[model samples]
Target: MAYFSVRNITKRYAAHTALSNVSIDVPEQSIFGLLGPNGAGKTSLIRIINQITGPDEGEVYFGNEKLAPHHVDRIGYLPEERGLYKKMKVGEQALYLAQLKGVSKADAMKKLKYWFEKFEIQAWWNKKVEELSKGMQQKVQFIVTIIHEPSLLIFDEPFSGFDPINVNLLKDEILNLRKNGATIIFSTHNMASVEELCDNIALINNSHKILEGSVKEIKKRFKTNTYSIDFDGFTGPVNPLLPGGFVLTEDKSDDDLRQVTVTLPATATQNELLNAFMPYVNIHAFREIIPTMNEIFIKTVHAAGNHSINS
Candidate 1:
């Protein structure tokens, strides 16, 4: 059973449709990625999920039960827009936020101290939020978000202002949360992070969902039937030796290694290409090329744009 499910959700603001019949199923204890460009309704969907706003149509469910107002306690949201009180001390603000989430003051302080010490930010405990750098403030917010240990966590652009070191630190913490049984909805423009962390994803475009699936399955679905091969000891032009249905996309040589990329025609198979190339040169490595999430995101959005025009 899905840990959380959004069923045919639709949201509108005045005359503008922010989301259109969007639905997603988040599996328990897994990292789920929500992706889209600006004005693509990702934020709207998130707001609806957080119960900060309501959908005009459809319902949201946590497990087998309908979502209720009190269910907000079960979720922790770190929005894209930072919300720290600039004049307030980090530790004080964190304690207040945790208490609001229903954590006892004693437990909150204990957890906060552990987190601060772990992140090496205990020195900033008495410092005002305005005194810290953007990344530092982000770290404080992250601690508060997870302080209550909610079952569901939603993070939007969680790594927006961090250096590589801090980015990896946060990544490790997110993975640890999933391992400890928290379902995470991670929204970001960083395709590399999605590739590294997400088990599944849903891509939205112009208020509509254009793609949704497990990351590996989505990449496979978008493949262009291309393969790269590395070889050596080729004496002549290798293009002509390719099978009739194969088209060489790139060919280059570095020392004794000849690297070539080929697009397979509909009639050709990987076995056929291997059979044809093996005779021409010493095959070093041959592997099918799958599209990256970044490439897939662009192509899918472009297709969605063209679809809107054609319709």
Candidate 2:
């Protein structure tokens, strides 16, 4: 059974619908990407899951049981909007937030110390939150969010405001968390991160889910059956060598070597494509071209005709 499931969830505020019949099943110990453009109801669904807001219709399930108020303690959320007590000392505030998540003060301090050392921010323990840079404050917020070791984590744009080095640091930590049996719902506009971290994803646009599946499956589902070939030596007109239902989309040459991209008919196989081009070109390398998450996201959203930002 899915560890967490959102079932036909719908939400509306006045006349504006934020989400409509949206659903996704997140498997345990997997990184699930929650994706969409701004104002696409990604935040709305997230808020519902965190119990910050209630769904007007439909239900949320955790471990096959219906979600309840008490489930809040089992989930960790790091919002895109950073929140900290600006006047409070970093360690003091972190301990307070951890306690709110049900961790005792003593334990929170111990965990905070470990995280601070790991992040090389031990010097900032007594510093006021306002004294830290945006990135530093973000690290503290992240530490507080996960200190309780919640079973399920929801991070919305967690990498925002960090430098590349810190981003990689956090990325590694996230992977480690998953390795240690944490189920994650990662929401972000960063397609490269989604490709690298997500096992599965669901894309919402205009308050509707336009796509959802394992990352590999979704890419394969939208594949165009295109293949790129690099070859040398023999060169001739591709039109005559082409079999029925094959078209060369690109052909470029450098000296004796030439590279070509071919689109195969839906009914055709790679072997058939290879055989058709064998006589005209000395094939050096061939690889199937897979669409990237960015391409798929734009294509699907455009196809849905919900291109304008709602907010």
Candidate 3:
């Protein structure tokens, strides 16, 4: 069974549909990305999962049972917007939040101490949250979110306000959490982060899910069969000897080295392309140009928008 499942979920606000029959299955202990454009109902689905709002239709399940109030204790949420109490001391506020998630005050302290030292924020413990920088407060919130060792964690743009070093720090911590058997649902506009952390992803567009799959499988599915070959001392215009299905999209000469890009036909193979180019030039480098998550996001969203318009 999936660790978390959203089954045909729908949510509406008056006449505007926030989500429409969206469903996704998140496997156990994996980092699942909940992705979409702005106002595409990713937040709505997240709200439903958090039990902050009920869906108009369908159901969500965790483990073997249907999600219920008790399940909230096992879930942690870190929103994009910081929610720490400004007037309270950082340790006090963290302890409060951790206890709310069902940890005892004593246990919370022990855990907070470890995290505070790990993050090197022990100095901020007694300081009021209002005095800390935005990034510092985010660290506090992150510690609080996981202090109870929740089974499920939902992080919305968790890297907000973090510098590159802190971003990498948090990324490593998150990966460690998954390694320790916690399930995560990550929602973000940062496609690069998605590529690095997500094992699987569901792309929601205009209140509907348009794409969902393992990151590797999705990348493979969208491959254009394009390759860039760099060779030293290649002759001018090798196009005349090109295979029937190969389309030469780019040709560039950088001093002594020549590089060309070609799109392979469905029936063609990389070996065939290499054979055609060999003997004429000394091949120095060759690589397939796989699409990045950013490219896939843009292409898929734009395609969905165009389809909506035409239909």
Candidate 4:
């Protein structure tokens, strides 16, 4: 069952329709990726999920209960647009924010100390926010967001402005949170990150949900029957050996291996593709080319009649 669910939500601002009957089900203790291009209604849906705004039509649920303002304490949100009081001491601000989320000051400080040490920011505790770098400030924000130990966490562009090392650190922390029973709602335009982190995803385009499924399932669904074969010692024209309706897309040589990629029609299988080349060359290896998340994102968005999505 979904720990958090948005059911046919619709929202509008003035004359602009920001969202139209969008729905998503975020399973418990899992990372659910909410993906889309800018102005594709992702922010609107997130707002509804966080109760920042109510939808014009449709109901929302937090577990068995209908969504309400009281549930705000159960969710932790780290928005893309980050802010902190530049003059406030780093430790003071983190403690204040955590208390606002209903945590006792003592507990908040205890949690903050653990996280600060874990993130190697213990030295920054007494420093003013302005004295820290952008990435350092982001670390503070991340700490406060989860300090309350909310059951659901929503992170929008969580990895922004960080170097590769910091990004990996945050990724590891996110996984640890899930392992400890926090369901995460993650939104980002970085497809490579999505491939690495998301278990399930919903793609929004033109204010509608265009695709939704587990990462592995969706990738399997988007297969194009493309295969790559590596061989050497073939001294004949490539086209002559190919069976009818086979498409040869790539041919190259790397070291001692000569590789070729082919697209097979429904009438043929990998066995048939292999059989044709078996007698003529020394086969090295062969493998199917599964579509990457970025490729699937671009292809799906284009096929849905929308363009300019992040690839």
Which whole-number lDDT from 0 to 100 does residue 8 have in model 4?
A: 91
The digit string of per-residue lDDT tens for model 3 on 126-237 reads: 9999999999999999999999899999999999889999999999999999999999999999999999999999999999899999999999999999999999866778
lDDT for model 1? 0.93
Q: How many pairs of residues collide in each model? A: 0, 0, 0, 0
Regions more than 4 Å wrong, model 3: 309-311
My TM-score estimates for the predictions, one after another, are 0.95, 0.94, 0.97, 0.95
RMSD (Å) per prediction: 1.7, 2.3, 1.4, 2.5
Clashing pairs in 3: none
Models sorted by TM-score, best on top: 3, 1, 4, 2
**Which model scores highest in TM-score?**
3
RMSD of 3: 1.4
After superposing candidate 4 on the true structure, give the runs of residues whose Cα lies further than 4 Å from its correct spot.
306-311
Candidate 2 per-residue lDDT, tens place, 1-311, comes to: 89999999999999899999999999999999999989999999999999989999999999979999888888999999999999999988998999988898888878999999999999999999999999999999999989999999999999999999999999999999999999999999999999999999999999999899999999999999999889886667676767788998998997777988999999999998889778767898999999999999999999876555542
**Local accuracy of candidate 4 as per-residue lDDT tens digits, 97-195:** 999999998999899999999999999999999999999999999999999999999999999999999999999999999999999999999999999
Instruction: Give Cα-based local distance difference scores for all models.
Output: 0.93, 0.93, 0.93, 0.92
lDDT digits (tens) for residues 93-168 of candidate 1: 9999999999999999999999999999999999999999999999999999999899999999999999999999
Q: For model 3, what is the C-alpha lDDT against the true structure?
A: 0.93
